[model samples]
Target: MKTVIRYPILFRAHPGRTEKPKDVLVPYLHEHDVPEISEAETHIAFRSQKYALVEYDGRLFSKVGKPGSNSAEACFGHAFEKEELRRRPWWIPTIEGDKVYIRYAGQPLDNLAYYRLYLDGGDKARETMIWPALTPDYQRHLGGPRSRNEFTFQGLVDKIRDINGVQFDAGREEHRAEAERLIVIDGSYWIETTPPAICVAHEGRMIVELSHLPNWLDHDLGRQYFPLTAKDEAIEYARRAQAITQRSEEPVRNFADWTDFRFDDNPLFAFDYEGYSLKRTTFLLGGDIARAMTGNGEIEGKIGSARARAVLSAKEGARSCGADYRTWPDASDLVHDVTDAWKMTGRKPGWTEIPPKRHEFGTMICERAAQMADSMPISVSARSTWTTSP
Candidate 1:
């Protein structure tokens, strides 16, 4: 199997009024502003102070927690889970329109993050908060909400402030409306609280615009087609298609010449090789390149089994399925299936009428016809070979 290497990168948040969230954007933001920020940033301490930023088109949501004053952890955890990280490089939620940033550990965010966000009040309340797993003393240091049922949104918020090391809600003390349509969320941030997440730091707010996320549910599979970017891929597609429909050639052309022929004193048939060149070419050719045994104009446009071709000019309903001579079961099956389907549907599956007028043989056809002129060619006529009138 071929291998592909994908490197993990972090986004950061910009400084503003409110303190940056530790679990999301602040860490990434630091890296963008810092020098030599790499994947290792999330693993270090002093260098892991950076952060990233991202703005999402959709809303960020949080999960609902179990009943209790300690529900804050559950709330934040839920929010974390709701963040569709895999879909977005980073995400930013807005509170009253102010941007709130979020990022990942060295690990990439998955579908679970989006689920967590919805669980939090982030979607409904439109508030931004962070949940730090690395802050060992965070719970001990920070207190809970006012009531048992009321989770301490302030505690996580405060922790985000201390660790994130950036202020996005700076001058905008009050909520403001977005400008035009391309509004930016340079107002929130995050910070690294522990080991795995440490590598996420060492960068400034990494900008992640949520509007760019992909919506898989809306993707239309019906319109999807295989890309022919490589020569091998194209060849493979053709080979698979050929395996489906048994044909002498990948592309069937010249239906009249796709058969065997012999020059016999059969008064009902006459082979017509317009020129001498085709006579020679046909004599040397063994497969479909050879002309039909009986020359009849009606067979020029017919496509059917050898048996069907043999009796084509004799009678309309006298043709056989040619199953005995078929090498591939699939070919016989298709012919039988199509024939049966057409019979049952009261519709003919193929046309056996010759064109009203033939094109000028030109040099190409002249050269080919000349080669076969000396030999009696195979012909699969749809009508009687004894008649010359249309």
Candidate 2:
């Protein structure tokens, strides 16, 4: 199993006026900022001094107790129950907008756009998403609203208990306004928290998944087909991709060749070789590279899966899902289970246009009809032995 890396980090709340409830930006502190967190919880003096928030996979805790209040002193009071955690919807509020900061929803996000999704401007309250998990202590620390029954939580505790707390008090605008942003969502954030073993897709679209703290040091399952930046890490990926262009032979110049790397006009890429060991094909932009699969211009442009070659669909869907078939077979069961869940819950559970793991081959065979030259050597189609996967 690939280990998910965790940063030894802390969140320190910036001091501001406490008169009215408002959002405060919390800065990320390196481990050295609070060296005590590195040791055993029982060994460290948790309440020695009111410490900053310690974070892991999103669930947080502090080192101090509330003054003159009848409350649990620290994290020891909370229950570590997946039983309950699996029931509540997990949400990541948009960073910035000066309203909320930092977000990490459970993996396999329903929409790819929401993986790193952000909200702009800090004016409106409706733009921000709310989670009931905000404890009074955390809210006070965060300088956010103190309604534990915020968002869908009120519906969970009050509305169902025959208490109309969600209703307006004498047509109070405040009450009605809060209700508007309170989006009621079902199913827990859990269902699937761990990243999939291999990239899995449902039908044609790729399934978007996330992992804890996807930074430069971490394995970012959440960031796929985004872009290869000029950062040091990206250069490594660019190296491997460039190597493909200089592979067994240079790509045919006169026609589009599948056996060789085909660069595209606008490229969307991912740095996945580190974990997946899959071949990274660089899609360069060239007029010859855009030739139709059929020798005859019977079909106007690249059709079927070929249509996915250069743009968003290919990187986000194909490479993101590990169509290269280089997954660690020992743990292939995880991929199977994730795919099954995706299919059963997908838009078309009955759809069968897609075949087995070799799904790409058949489609390519029919769509691909490219070669070097007509009178010379045979046009090398990407033909492979037909095999079935268990």
Candidate 3:
């Protein structure tokens, strides 16, 4: 997928203006006609020089008057350079191969003229660095100094915001509120862009950009809605969500210590649960356990197959243990299956053992189970007496 940024202002130049140049000039000089030398001595005189101005057919051209000047050598040199010089240079007429040639050994007049006109201004930096780097194609794209597509860094922030329709401050608050309303309507959602990046909100209060997060952590928080719980376990749940998304590594050693990086306390990450209940807690817990067990930590290899097996195993275990509670499996049984599958697959079992005495949810599950068992009647009369007393 192509990368997307939340605010387009982060890029160096406007997208519309940064296109590659089309009219880049070729580096090497082109072939041109050589002027005839009037005599052998003239050819010999200019043979030692690299360049010469030649007068030929009442017109002048710059020709390569290299050594061993023969008639055939007169037809080749840079045509562009000759044009730039206005066909004027001091020359001596000579004969070579019985044809007249003009040879002059001097600096390229056109280049000197160009330097005097364009480079004479106090823009040494542009001449020395920028101008040299610009190819003929780029120069054509530039079209000159007054072209509309020229890039400028000034007022860039406002320009970016205008182009991308991004909100800030008070406007951002409204956007955040809308996001929270949408999340409550659905469970969770992704805010997509052309070049994609992931950003999430919590309770319309905090926004986090997953792109800035570690790859493992970002993948772990796979686009999903989380259940709200007590602060500690909610954070733990978020961490586990990340781990489940990871599917390759052992469970985190100290989930509490993990950081929850946020961009700001904007409405973008807000939640509205004024009428919600805690009944789904068990199911959410079961889902988390199932997710945690499925894959090895590695990003590549047979993660898909492993996760499939883990899910199947968890379901089977839940059924055998009579733990499936309609919408979700039993949390305890799910955790057990997940750990067993991880061990079977030669992966680290990251979660704490079940029937956990100190674990927050584990202790809750055990206490709840014990309470139910105690409430059951030992005999028919005992059940009747308890019912009557209640």
List residue ranges in candidate 1 displaced over 4 A. Answer: 1-131, 134-167, 170-390
Worst 10 residues of 1 by lDDT: 194-203
lDDT of 1 by residue, 1-390 (tens): 111111111122222345543234212111122112223222211111122222122222111122232332232222122222333322222123433233222222222222222223222321133332213244554673322123323333443334322322420110011101111122212222211100010011111111212111101111111111222332343343333332414442221122222222322111121221121122111111112212323333343445343223222111111111111111211222222222232221111111111121112222323333324355566765576667
Among residues 3 or more apart in sequence or in different chains, the pairs in candidate 2 whose N, CA or C atoms overlap within 3 Å are 108-209, 263-283, 263-284, 264-283, 264-284
Root-mean-square deviation of candidate 1: 31.4
RMSD, model 2, all Cα superposed? 21.2
- How much does candidate 2 score in TM-score? 0.19
Q: Of the candidates shown, which would achieve the greatest TM-score relative to the real structure?
A: 2
The sequence of per-residue lDDT tens digits that candidate 3 reaches over residues 1-390 is: 111111101111233344431111111221122222332212111121232222222222233323334421222111123331322222222222322333111112122222222222222322222222233345666564222112222323343322322312322332232222111001111111111112322221222222111111111112222211223434444453333232324342332122332222222223321101111222223223343432324412333555445445543432232111123223332333333333344432222222211143233432443343344445433454454435
Q: What's each prediction's TM-score?
A: 0.15, 0.19, 0.18
TM-score-superior candidate, 1 or 3: 3
Order the candidates by TM-score, highest first — what do you get? 2, 3, 1
**Total clashes, candidate 3?**
39
